[model samples]
Target: MSEAPALPPVRRVGQRSTLAYGFGAAAYGVKDFGFSTFLLLFYNQVLGLPAAQVGFAIMCALILDAFIDPLIGFLSDNTRSRWGRRHPWMYAAALPIAAGWLLLWNPPELSQDAMLVWVFATSVLVRTAISAYEVPSQALTPELSADYDERTRLTAYRYLFGWAGGMVTLFVTYTWLMAGPDGQPDQLNRANYAGFALFGAAAMLLAIFTSAIGTHGEIKRLPRPEIVTKPLGTHFRELWATIRNRAFLILMLAGLCYYSAQGISFALATYLYVHVWQFDTAAFGTLALSLFLGVSGAFVIAPRVANRVGKPVAAMVFMFSAAALLATPYALRLAGLFPAPGDRVMLPLLLTLFAFNTGCGVSATMLGASMMADVVEDSEAKTGRRSEGVFFSGAFFIQKCCSGLGIFAASLILHFAGFPKGAKPGTVGVEAIDRLTLYFILAYLALGWAAALIYRFFPFGRDEHAARVAALAKGEAG
Candidate 1:
């Protein structure tokens, strides 16, 4: 087996470069905002498809795209190009992502079955296109810096911008595009989605191009793997061996659980806001601001916390904290100890809890991703290969699959709650809303706790990662 050639030492990435790299995640954030926050509502309420069918179509798309992520990752890893391995794929994905984003929200009138097929196909296209960029783009994290704290900081930037992009778009959608003439939110108006879709497509295109171009200068500084003549089976064997690292597997399990909880929260956000909370346009905008502020707080909090405790411990702490806070509002409401849905105090209270919840949750996620970057060195030390693409893609693969399940679970929640189709805000029965809140609280807490506990099983810390990095450096020096 050929080891990867040593190319460059880890250096502190410059602010410009870090910002560029981080901004690229906005493209993905835009895609996520559409899929997680709006897709179900648009299809179910605006287009008149059933919630279960929308969820099924999206789940299928996500699962299919999950399989495609590894291929993109593998191809990007092995590709030899003057522009370097990752950027070409990132550049190639921009236009398709834009087109797919447009098509996904602009489906023409069709029978329910045909619409389902359209939803499935467009969703697959969008997800695959985004994966082409994201898998490779994220794979850049480990290559850019191998330092423990630096990776955490970089990951924080990525999450901050990702959340900012999504939240900004969301804020704009609720306050402007989706608002009625009377200044209330009118999300069920099909015409409102056209502007949202266009804005998202444009944002995605700009983000992809900006990041690919912005980071283009680092091509020569990144690692250059040795060209080896390996047969198809050998490559697959190596890929499998690399991903089978114990730490990587543990992180994947944690990600599966964490992202599942996130998916449920995101998929049901609009439902909870509109039906249960009766939030108006102003309230939605404020919620988006709160979420953005939370993630920004995470940008400051994650690395500091990870530096104090180990990444795994910090992640577990944040995960557990986030879960408890997330469940608090629902539990309070269910217990009849919370503000009424339309109470003046309800919005502020919810926003405050959500801000803290997002801060903790995003911190946990940042630490986990940084942990994955650390895994690259650990795997390279053990296997004589640096498989950043494979590792990150594997992480994303788990996230997409599990999050898909979460979305499906959300649909089930709605179905079982007997949430009526086309029901306006404030009209959903108290019983159904209560049922929805209970189911969400239960699932969210269960998954959150499971993920936090699973994080404890991660076998390495900063010291282990440092040792692996030094070992790899020594081997290369020899």
Candidate 2:
């Protein structure tokens, strides 16, 4: 009874413009590391909260994030705005994140219980506001370009920028935030307030400006669809169908496992390096530098590797390689062979494993983003609607929810393993350290294998995506 809107032309997005959006996408990771990497340490070390209480606080905040993300996606999809659905929210999130980052870092004078409440409440508000922007920001990708190779390029660029942001945060946090003025490493130092707050604020502003400038003409204003104006129930039903799509479902599962391992591993890093390896706080920077380089190198090389071998094969190979390498630390430690506590053996181990796993991680990032785009096309084919918001919402759901689960798991595991907050030395036992190391190794192995299996079920690799694009050219949605 209603005419379907004419399909928008698949524009060729150039490297510069795409990279700009990628920078914006990556800037979000600044906030990510802010929360995941430093927040627990902040509460436990600076605020004097215990490990169990810190873990409990994080879980509560994550639960809030889990419930709010989908609702934000649903609202963002239906929003009618002249500045565009995503950008308006993107700009709005900047201030809240800045304020929240400041608040999380410098809590007002309050009891530990009151401090927990403040952190939990503000974290929920900050992350929720961020999702409001991020879900829609990602939704813009499919709308920006539909070419198969173009999507991969965009992902690569974004991954690089995101990795850059993460690395910057890591260096500053580990080096300056935790160091005393005498250039000595002091785990208790919090005077690096200027450095942390400045970067967070800078990233937030840079992202807003980049999104506004980079995507000015890239995103064409489409006539608002009557179908999109339907009731909330209609949107929920459509979102349900999108979730049920097999390719998306599998990817979501894989993301949950892979990021869970990643999250847990990151949370455990300060402890592992200090107590287990007996390295100073500065070693965290060295290890992070190696990890960042490894992952960065992988992102750079992934496009060519995916082009030569199939994306799935490349992804599978890298995933397994990462799993093997991640275990090297544990293997060496268990064998009573690690460098003495202060010898920086962890640096060499990190470098070796990171070299291989970095490439693997790069391949995974490329494959994962492209896979989601393909699924979006496939869903459009079946449903006869261009629902990029819903599509990316599902993608965001998988990625964030899984990473949140990972962080959640890490919090619980650390508490159970007796890993004390602030590395309150000798409070946690050697038994706990052994168990934690084993947990890290086994968890990464399972996550890597599970992600590979999910890729197997996803039929939208390079060739398939090309075919799908060709079909779209011939006036068929599939």
For TM-score, the strongest prediction is 1
For candidate 1, write residues 1-478 as lDDT tens digits.
Answer: 2333463366789999999999999988888888887888889888889999889888988767656988888888888888888999999999999999899999998999999999999988888888899999999898888888888878888998899889989988999989988667998999888899999999989988999999998877788878698999999899888878999999988888889999999989989988878888888889998999899899998898788888999999999999999999999998889998778899899999999999999999889999999888888878887788888888877766765677788888999999998888777889999999999999999999999999998898988777777777888521
Q: Where does candidate 2 clash, by residue pair?
A: 260-406, 278-341, 294-358
Lowest summed lDDT over 10 consecutive residues: which window, candidate 1?
A: 1-10
lDDT of 2: 0.69
Over 317-406, each residue of candidate 2 has an lDDT whose tens digit, in order, gives 767667777777677788887654546554676567766776676578567776676676777677765666666676666665555556
**Runs with alpha carbons beyond 4 Å of true place in candidate 2:** 1-8, 181-184, 193-195, 221-228, 341-346, 424-429
lDDT of each: 0.87, 0.69
Task: Give me candidate 2's TM-score against the actual structure.
Answer: 0.90
- The collision pairs in model 1 are none
